[model samples]
Each structure stands twice: as structure tokens, then as C-alpha cells.
Target: MTPIVVPVPGVFPYEQLGFTNCVRHGDVLYLSGVASLDAQGQVIGDDIDAQTVQTYENIGRILAAGGSSLDRILQMTSFVVDLGRNGGGYVATRARILKQPTYTSAVIGVSALMMTGLLVEVQCCAAVSN
Candidate 1:
């Protein structure tokens, strides 16, 4: 099993957090939960709409680095801090980012996230052909 790690310039060192961006075992790519953080590792956006966009963009970069794409995504799990206000917003944003047939997904509402003002987090699984 070969593990793949996608490192964005100036992104936080995941080792301190005890995780990698993505891990590849055979053809399957497992991505860690991604937050809407900028290159400086600071959370971005003021609302769910903006945060969701950044989250998807981070996922896109990871997929591309792992030799995959959004179309190859097999599963997605999203966590939202405010289910009532931002849940639908995340889905609507995803629909625009991922225009292809939707993959299996789970949206969970939680009391809070690791950071303040952080509304959403997303993780995904993708399979790439050799």
C-alpha cells in the first residue's frame, strides 16, 4: 500500500495533527477531512457559501495530486456546525462544484467544529485507474 500526501504550499504540517492529506492503498484514495483554510492555514470565508467553495477547492487539489478528479470520487462525508442554516448551502455549493452524477454522501450536523467560525468540513474517497 502506497500512501499519497498532497501538500499545499504553506499548509499546516499534518504530522502534528497526526494525519495526512490523502492516503492511497492500491487504487483507492482516502482523503482526510478538509476544512476551508487558506494557504496560510487560516480558515477562510465568512459564511457557509464561501466556506463550502474553499472546502471543495481543497478537495479538488488533493484529488488532482493523487491522479484523480471529482468525477472519480466514490464517497463524500460532510460535517456542518449549523445544520439548519448551512446544511442546504453546502449541498447547493457542492452541486455547482461537482456537476457530474452525484456520488454516495453523508451530511452530518455537529455542535461545533475545531475552529470558531468554521462551518463545514469535508472528506472524500476516490478510485483511480492505473
Candidate 2:
């Protein structure tokens, strides 16, 4: 099936950067790695916990725009900078936000991300409703 780009309002212009925020194909939604970026692509948070919250907020917006929700998430991969220091915070914050650990997920260590202050980037997939 053909993929359709999902339009998320108030998100940064990832299109100009040669990528889309989310796309739907058949019953599945694929999201690019979402960071705590504002409308201008500036990092929004100072630390891992705050950035993890903002990252999930961004993911929620994109998933909703694609006819999905965080509850429908099938899998997620989080790229984290400074895994030794920030990994626990990222996990704890994610647990608080999600409430249920229902989705398949992994957190990977990385040296850096797209932006200087970015501590986490979440790439996700979910089931879109018919």
C-alpha cells in the first residue's frame, strides 16, 4: 500500500530537512525519531527527564495526526545521549507518562543527536485504526 504523510500541527518543519514526522501505510504508522524540538527545531528541554517528556509529547501529536495513539504503539526505540547518566531518568519519565509498559521498546546509547541539547530521540510505530 502507498504511504501517506501525516500532518502534525505546530511541529517543526522536518519536511524541509528531507523527512516526515509520521506516515501511515495500511494499518500501520511509522514515525521518525522525535526529539524535544520546538517549531524552529530548537531543543526544548535541558535534561533527560524533561526532554523525555517533551519527546513523548511530540510522539503523541504525530501519532494522533496519523490516526493512532500512544496506547496503540507496537514498538519504540529511544536513542539516548549519555546513557550512563540519563538512561534511568529517561526510563522513569517514560514509565510515569505511559503508566503501563505495554509497548516493545529499547533505549540505545548514542554520542549525540541532531541538536546540541537533545538528550533523547524516540522513534515509534503504532497501529492506525481502520
State every prediction's TM-score relative to the real structure: 0.89, 0.96
RMSD of 2: 1.0
Q: Tens digit of lDDT per residue, candidate 1, span 2-111?
A: 56565543444455678888887778888888889876678899899999998888887777777788889999999999799889998899899889865899999998
RMSD of every prediction:
1.8, 1.0
The candidate 1 region of ten consecutive residues with least summed lDDT is: 6-15
Candidate 2 collision pairs: none
Residue pairs in collision within model 1: none
Compared with the true structure, model 1 gives a TM-score of 0.89
Model 1 ranges off by over 4 Å: 2-11
Residue 26 miss distance in model 2 (angstroms): 0.6
Model 2 Cα lDDT, one tens digit per residue, 1-130: 8899888998886899898998888899999999999878888989998898888888988888888888889999999999999999999999989887778999999999987889999998999865
lDDT of each: 0.83, 0.90
Give the number of the best model, judged by TM-score: 2
